[model samples]
Each structure stands twice: as structure tokens, then as C-alpha cells.
Target: MQVDVAILIIIYAYVTTLVVLWFLMKVRPKFPSGISIGIVVFLGIATTMAVVTILEFAIAPVGRPASRVISIARGLKIAAIEETMKLIVAALGILIAKNEAKWVDTKLSLAFVSGFTFGITEALFYVARNSYSLFGLVNLFLSRLIHPVFTVSLVGGILLFRYGKRIEGVLVASYSYLGHALLDHYLTACACYISSAVILLALASFAGAVYLLMPKIEAERKQRGEFEKEATVELKDHWLNKM
Candidate 1:
């Protein structure tokens, strides 16, 4: 009902960063099949919401940040639910393609594609239910946009697991979850101290991280033939789609 420092900063930074991501993804990017992407999007929204709702009710006395311990606990719970639900959708193609000896481009693409769609779908619902005004739009950016952007950070992590980097994969996965959880916790419990500058800084840092790892993901994409036939040779990191 009320906008706070954290809310304002999140909205502004998210909207700006999303614009940048759109531009980056425009670079002769290879998109997923229409049917596959559509299925993943539907799966992402339906499963994520359904499972989150079930968990919320099952837990009861949901974390309201009455205390730091409670806040962290709640934040971890939320992170666990979100990560697991998203992964479930991402795993579909992989599970079906498990028998294939060769690499499946579509399976790998599923990770980011599902992530991107899930972020947008969730954002739309959140805006409609909470606020559809300017404030609502900002909320959508924060709540919806960030999830997919953050999940893009998982490209390396997923690859690590796909290839034989078990330890590294676990480490990356852990870091990703903690990073996502910490952001949520801070926004929920420490909103009063957050600022637009801080939000911008976080987004800039994330964009930089994406820029750094995109090459590795694209390298794999190319090796696996996951990209469109027509594309730019040099890939520059603009923002996020990494879904």
C-alpha cells in the first residue's frame, strides 16, 4: 500500500536494467522454438505459483520479519521454493532427453527460456493483483524482471552440472541461491535503509557479472548449435535474458 525507500529503488533500477537487457538480447540472438518456449512459460507460471502457494499455507505463520532470524529463515524458505520450482520446469527437456548420448541444445536452452518466461509471467500477475499504476509497473520490474535476470547468472552453474563439474556446480548454485535470498531478505526486512543509488549499484554489478559469463554460455551454445543461424560474431553483454 505504501512505497518505501527499497521499493522505489527496486522499481527504478529494475525498469532501467530490463531496458538494457532487451537491447542486449537483440543481438542476433537465437530464440527457442515457439512451441517449446510456450510450454515452458506456461509450466513456469503454473508450477511456481501453485507450489509457492502450497508452501505458504503449509508453513503458516509466514515470515513477517518480526526478527532477523525469522526474516532469514523465511527468506531461505522462499528462495528454496522458487529455485526448486523453476528448476523443475527447466528439467523437463533434459529428463526426456536423458537417454541421448549427445548434447541437446533445446534442453540447455530450456534453462534460460523458462527463467525468462517465468519472470515475466509472475511479474504480470503481481502487477495485476497489487498495483497496475506506475507503482505497479515498477513493482512488476522488481518482482518479475529480477528473477529471470538472476537466473541467467546460473548458466555457468548449470553447465558445470551438465558437464562433470559437480563441486563447482554446487558452489555456484549455492552462491546463486544465497545471493537471491539475501536480496529478498534485505528488501523485505531492511527496506528503510535501501536507496536508489544502492539499487542501481546492485543492478550494475549484476549486469557486469552477466557480461563476463555470457561468452562462456554462448560458446557452449554455439558448440551445441543452440543459436540462430544468423547472428553477430561478437556478443556483447547489454543486460539479461539469460533466462
Candidate 2:
């Protein structure tokens, strides 16, 4: 149960991000229901692990040392599993947000918060199982970032889909999946493919996408505000008339 500095940093990052998300959700006006947050968290963990495990077992022959054919097959399997998990998580997050309507903003925030929680928990498990070295800690830090980043991207897509652009949401989700898969592939080959240029490019792409979508997100917030005001008036009227 030895804890490395990198692991400590990752845990701190995850917790700090989550606390900020919580504060934002609370101070920003409206937020999702308790039930909705629970559902998103549950699906995030269940869907990702289920898909990863299934792909691992299905491609066992490919992962075997003796068969080059099997090795190639396993690689493809791993890629597919990773990409699919990203896409599914993103899509599901958006879908949940859509269902919650006015709570889309809070739901999106919670989705990423939940994702960070899952990533940190999984990293702890991985470090516990493996050797706890500086390298292992760095690996955990990078791996932990994966979940939050992917989730954030997915939440962005979901917000777009809820507003007026379903296609944009799908595109964002797809990009997140591909981006995650590429990052994972690169990291898996870090020993040989330690190219800072490539890593920076990928990070830039993700950051750029998020930046581009900020305005739309702000617009959505305004819309949610209007919806909340209308709902409050309606509720007040209904109760007054009943009284």
C-alpha cells in the first residue's frame, strides 16, 4: 500500500476538480436531480468496465505470445473496446442530460465529476495491484486524466445535442472516443513512441474543441435560466390556485 507522489497528485487533482464542479453546480442556479446524477455515475462505471472486459476476453487468442496474427487481432480488439467505451459514455451522458432538460448543465458537470471519481478509483486499484514507483505514479496520473477529459468532452456534446444540434453532439462524442483511443495507444507504446510533438498536438486538439464550444454552452445556460423562471412561476400559480 505504498503511495507515490504522482498518485498523490492525481488524487488531489481529481478531488479538487470534483469540489469545484460541485460548487459551480450549486452556485450556478439550477442543477440535476439526485437520481439523474446517480444514474450517470452508475452507467459510466458499468459500461466502460463491461466493454473493456468483454473485448479483453474475446481477443485472448490475439494476445497470446505465439501467434502474430492473434497479436494483431488483440491490438484491434483493444482499440475497438477503448474507442467504443468513450463513445458510449459520451453519448449516454448527453442522453441523460437531454432527459433532465433544464438540468443539462448540472448533469453535464456531474457526469465529468463522476468520471473523475471513477478514474481516480481505478488508478488506485491499478497502482495497488502493480509496483508503486514514480513511473507507475505518472502512468496513473495520465490515465486518471483520461476519464475526466473524455467525460468533459462528452458532456459538451450532450449539451449541444440538447440545444439544437444533434449532429454536433455526435461529432464531439466521436472525436472524444478517437482522441482517447489515440492517447491510450500512444501511452501504451511510450517506451518507443515518446514524441512530445504528437502528445502536444493531441492535447491541443482536445483543448481547441472545448474552447470552440464554450459560447454554445453559455447560450444553453441562458436558456436554462429562462426555463427555470417559467417553471417557478407555474409552480407558484398552481399552488396558489389550489390554496
The TM-score leader among the candidates is 1
Where in model 1 is the C-alpha error above 4 Å? Answer: 1-12, 15-23, 26-29, 55-70, 94-109, 161-171, 192-243
lDDT of 1 by residue, 58-165 (tens): 111113455542355676787777776677777763454443313433443566666667666666555455435686465555545555545544544665655676
Weakest ten-residue segment in model 2 by summed lDDT: 58-67
Number of clashing pairs per prediction, in order? 1, 1
Candidates in order have lDDT scores of: 0.54, 0.52
Between which residue pairs do clashes occur in model 2?
62-70
TM-score of 1: 0.63
TM-score of every candidate: 0.63, 0.59
Best by lDDT: 1
